[model samples]
Target: MDSMIKTGIIELEEMEFYAYHGCFREENVVGNRFLVNISIRTDMTRPMQTDNINDALNYVQVYNLVRTEMQQTSNLLEHVTARVMDSLCRHFPDIEWLRVKISKMNPPMGGQMRNVSVTLER
Candidate 1:
């Protein structure tokens, strides 16, 4: 038997923070805005009826993990995105796959906005 469930998109925008994640000295001290988007895939067959939070992946807990990751310092967006994915996978073993994206808005670049992100599956 095959069972799969689609958990709709969960997005967190304009999550401002101060972090030393840039190569430049000035950029490290002056942080920028970070946006995170996470998509979680799991089997909802059991949780659908039981209505037990433990039976399924808790989105609230996922959000908190992202927040906690942002608090840490990473010099690369890829690292940030990977950390988010790893954290989520560890927290919710029921999840079969996860897609995580992290964007750094309004970067130190002189011209247009700076946005970098990565997607990972586990």
Candidate 2:
């Protein structure tokens, strides 16, 4: 068996966005902050040698896609994550696999705690 190349971790933190996504009525109307982190597995065999941007995955475009998707309204974080994964796979065919984590900060819960996040893969 041959070992595949890894592109390491790519993270985007504190990406604040206002989206109407939640089960509660106020959540949809009021909206909240969201943070997204994406990890992509790319075949770096060529880029390592050529040192070309096109040879490897373009992460900036991927981040843009995630940002655009997060702007839309959705009922659940799972749905948003799935959409992100699908979009990423469609845009970047070189990616063998991807992990997307969507976080909803300061959820309507009455407790003082960190945000809620959902991770999905494709």
Candidate with top TM-score is: 2
Poorest lDDT segment (10 consecutive residues) of candidate 2: 1-10
Please list the residue runs of candidate 2 whose C-alpha ends up more than 4 Å from where it truly belongs after superposition: 1-14
Candidate 1: stretches off by over 4 Å: 1-18
Model 1 agreement with the true structure over 15-57: per-residue lDDT tens digits: 4555656667876778777778777767677667677977766
Please, what are the lDDT tens digits per residue for candidate 2 over residues 1-122? 12364454455555667687898999989998888888877767677778899786787898789888988889899999899899998998878778888888898789986899999987
State how far residue 119 of model 2 sits from its true place (Å). 0.6
Q: How far is 73's C-alpha from truth in model 1 (Å)?
A: 0.5
What do the candidate models score in CA lDDT, each in turn?
Answer: 0.72, 0.81
Clashing pairs for model 2 are none
